[model samples]
Target: MKIGVLALQGAFYEHRKMIEQLGAECIEIRQLSDLTSNRFDGLMLPGGESTVQGKLLAELGITEPLRNLINAGTPVLATCAGLILLAEEIEGGEKPYLGTLPVAVKRNAFGRQLGSFEYTGSVGDLKDFKMTFIRAPIITAGHSDEVQTTAVFEDKIVAVKYRNQIGLAFHPELDQDTRIHEEFLELCKSFSLNK
Candidate 1:
């Protein structure tokens, strides 16, 4: 299946490489007008500065289109700052999120970028995956009925799945494991088939 990576900013190129390595067509989306239904089977919002990314989305007038895409059952895999963008609410900031997932987020909860570290945890479909957090946010809690935690760090939920949306608080692409990407592809397949 084809996957679209929001290339607005941050480490989106790395996500593109990872997806392409899995033999899937990867499309780099720079603007809202590039968001066409036929271009990809799923979308990946990469890790970046949430405040900047949020402003960029609003400036480009893509907030509603993206929300509509999620509403229409399009699979979305968001990481790090992308995770913040997917939250229903964000603490310590006024930036509004996409509110696609039933969870709250706190940006830079793990300390500054220099305080980043590598942590290993188990997820729902995959276990013992190594995750790297660079100024990552934390998924404090989620709705019991809709949450499927893939991993956690220091007792805080770091990775979760709500419906077709997968939110991760670390940079999985920066690591050697492909399980997360594979899981995302599987979610995309399920979403495309309307499962």
Candidate 2:
């Protein structure tokens, strides 16, 4: 399976490495041509400056195309700042991008860089899931019933599955555990066959 990773900016390399380790072709999507030329089974949005990524996406003419793909039921794994892009709203009134996932996110709710932490908690069905947070955003609220809350940190929603899109407030790709990526790749496999 081939996965297209948004490489405009962020921890995209980390995501790419994880995808490769899982036996998938990882394509770095830096421009509109990258998206148009690729036949990827899934999309990965890694943690980074959400505002900058959003600006570059629009400037590079990739916002609409990427959104369309996600809206068309393409499997996507969005983490940290990536989660901010997909949310329907930004909790503090910052702009929203993509807006494919029906949840509101509070950017850097866990604090700045010095506030980052690693925790072992339940993520979806993985009870002992370990996740890393780096200036992560928290899903404050869900705007649709389709948004199924999967994992919570400190009683706040950290992960959710909305249809084919999976949003996470923590960096699963940053860890050695491949469970989350494996699950997403399985979704991609199913989607590839069905599509």
TM-score of each: 0.94, 0.98
Candidate 2 regions exceeding 4 Å error are none
Question: Highest lDDT: which candidate?
Answer: 2
Kindly list the per-residue Cα lDDT of model 1 for residues 66-180, writing each as its tens digit. 8888877889999998998889878765656688888888778889979899877677757778889999899876855778877878788888888779999999999879988
Q: Model 2, residue 152: displacement in angstroms?
A: 0.7
Per residue, candidate 2 scores C-alpha lDDT tens digits across 1-195 of 899999999999999999899899999999999999988899999999999999999999999999999998889999998999999899778778999999999988988999999999888888798999999889999999989999988898999999999999999888899999999999999999999
* lDDT by candidate, in order shown: 0.85, 0.93
Worst 10 residues of 1 by lDDT: 32-41
